[model samples]
Target: MLREQGSAIRNTLDSVLSLSNQKAYPVWESVNSFALIKAAEAGLGITILPENLLLDSLLHKKLRLIELDGIDMENKMLAILHKDKNITQPLKIILDNISNVL
Candidate 1:
């Protein structure tokens, strides 16, 4: 996955323009932190995000974050679910997986 850099991989027209020595488009402008994470999740590109954002069940299997040679931004993720819904056996398995991974 790519991060919010001027010369990273992106699929927008502005990103294309920037490659041709033209001005950048605001919609294609890259931001730091969660903006990169959100964009990656949306399939715009892959990225290397901090470990902390993957703490919740919603992200456990939905994405895969990679680590490189010397990165030091590991973190945790936290989430909350409804209390009234009956916890099913399959869901319990998913929760167990989340706990084991994070």
Candidate 2:
């Protein structure tokens, strides 16, 4: 496994893999997305990353998507704020923009 350190997908990836019968593989973990992509391009191993991050490489055929059988690796972004906290005008506008875009 090629793992991205401190990535949100790490937890979900672990949970999904644990439920399967696949054997554990050695991991090359890094926090740098560029390094991860370089490693993958060099045929070191496969990794899971946001599609937007690798769009250019994918289009150039430098990397290819490896479909995982019976796995849903899709993820959604969530913006959380404390209910007790006050929402300032700027914050509200930012949140509204994000909500509208999404």
Give TM per candidate: 0.33, 0.69
Over the stretch 1-102, how does candidate 1's per-residue lDDT look in tens digits? Answer: 443454323333335455557843343445565676667668776654445654452356666656554423433455567979788899889988999877
User: How would you encode candidate 2's per-residue C-alpha lDDT over 1-102 as one tens digit per residue?
Assistant: 445534676766766777885543547777777788888889888878777778888999999987777788766788999989899999999999988765
Cα-based lDDT at residue 17, candidate 1: 50
**What is candidate 2's CA lDDT for residue 49?**
73
How many steric overlaps are in each model, in order?
6, 0
Lowest summed-lDDT stretch of 10 residues in model 1? 6-15
Q: What is the clash count of model 2?
A: 0
lDDT of each: 0.55, 0.76
The Cα error of candidate 2 at residue 77, in Å, is 2.6
The TM-score leader among the candidates is 2
